[model samples]
Target: MLENTQISILGCGWLGFPLAKHFIAEKSTVKGSTTSADKVADLKNAGIQPYVFTLGANNNADVYRNFVAESDVLIINFPPKRVEHIETLYPAQIQEIASHIRFRQKVIFISSTSVYQNTNDWVTEDLVNQPEKASGKAILAAENILREKLQNRLTILRFAGLFGYDRAPGRFLANKKELSSANAPINMIHQDDCIRLISAVIRKNVWGEIINGCADVHPIRKRFYILAAKKLGLQPPEFKEETTVSFKKISNLKSKMLLQSTYKYPNPLVFVL
Candidate 1:
């Protein structure tokens, strides 16, 4: 347990909300920021200290400054949304926050496996980043800025496709037709595992490392999504009987090795809502 520790999380949506709750349960002082005013009550109800931290050129800088100043550790949880002109908006937002982060505070930046181009093979943390999409490129750029600004104070977590909770893969592709990458391996992690990894990192004070957060199992997309939909009683998606060269199986060996003896939802295939 982190005693008398203050942790601030930027972006309390999806993954960050649960993570903040976990830390609060462990007796850590947690301050969380949300872009929505409605979510402020939700965060407070979950035992989190909530603030409205909207992103923009004219965002309240004092709110962010106070948040950073009051925390011992900060986790930057805002990911680049796959939207129009996100390639520019994403990095700018991150840069604004990075500039305000106080000195000597430990930082965690949530990244994505999309930073790696489809390598058609197993990839580890050592693999060179070759982003294919705009979101990927934006995230990679934000990561570089954090590394440069925070130096050894930052830890990067490149999460695989996040599923579980309200984001079940079953509904994602249900009834979709002519899907590509039928045989491509599914690299994903349950939300429980995602929370666990982030918790372990903070508790153990693991810093200055780049770790991949994902399940060990790599079931093919067609098989996994079809089974998922069947279990949910939704329409199973159809996929062409073909294999694509654009695919990569992310390995969590580095995370396992670093977090020693910790395991939660290692195989995403067995994950149930």
Candidate 2:
């Protein structure tokens, strides 16, 4: 069903860039946006019709409106920066984007599994009301805004920690001291599986649903990080002794059942670079 469809991805950064290429490979017309004019050449070289865009409460609407008007599907891949005052800026930008799009068009919102707090329980898409961090709260707020505006035309995908290519988390805390949550179960997804699930959702025309995208296995924090570090010949991270444990395992059953996803990396521990 995607073959001749026009797809536009807003904020074509790490994930969105590859996703745009994926759709283009599937014979779909792909248009992508970047805030940096320097990156326009990169997107154009990757076979994506590139456009310059800056989204916010007061930003120009004609650019975004024109981008949305040309596509059959619009993917909101804009993520809030990890800085102070992100909580307010995140939803404001989404609200502005929501005002430009019509309810009749299809929209896929990129959300995060962080919306589920560390409740030490198995979490699903239904538990989005319990965000623990600023980023989670911001994402949940954006999801709500888009859902209300687009209604049934919207689909929310709450992806777990995305790690693949040069984005490995093992190197993030290498040789770190006194790290907490050593025993907390990790919920991460490879970039390959993420693209597959999203492609399936669009091909099947699945809308008006919330899906969690993650791997099946849940490895403890220390174990996964140590192994990941060793694979790269990097210093293994040290974790403090655990006196209190709190974590959550993100369940991907909704995605499997609804999106019909068969993961490429079912067991995260065996995932090799």
**Residue pairs with clashing backbones, model 2:** none
Residues forming the 10-long window of minimal summed lDDT in candidate 2:
53-62
Write one digit per residue (lDDT tens) for candidate 2, span 1-273: 789999989879989999999999999999898999999899999999988867763567787788888677899987898979988989998888778786477999989997888878999777647788999999988988998788889999999988988797768778888898999999999988988988998999999999999999989888888888888888988999988999999999989999777999988888533
Predicted candidate 1 versus true structure: per-residue lDDT over 1-273, tens digit per residue = 577789999989889998898888889999999888889789889989888867774768898898788798999998877789998889989988888888899899999998988888899999889899999999999999899998889999999989877998888899899988888888898888888888878878889999998888888888888998888999999988764446999989988889762557777788533
Using all chains and alpha carbons, the TM-scores for the candidates as numbered come to: 0.96, 0.96
User: What lDDT score goes with residue 14 in model 2?
Assistant: 81
Worst 10 contiguous positions by lDDT, candidate 1: 259-268
Candidate 1 Cα outliers beyond 4 Å, as residue runs: none
- Clashes per candidate (backbone, < 3 Å): 0, 0
Predicted model with the maximum lDDT? 2
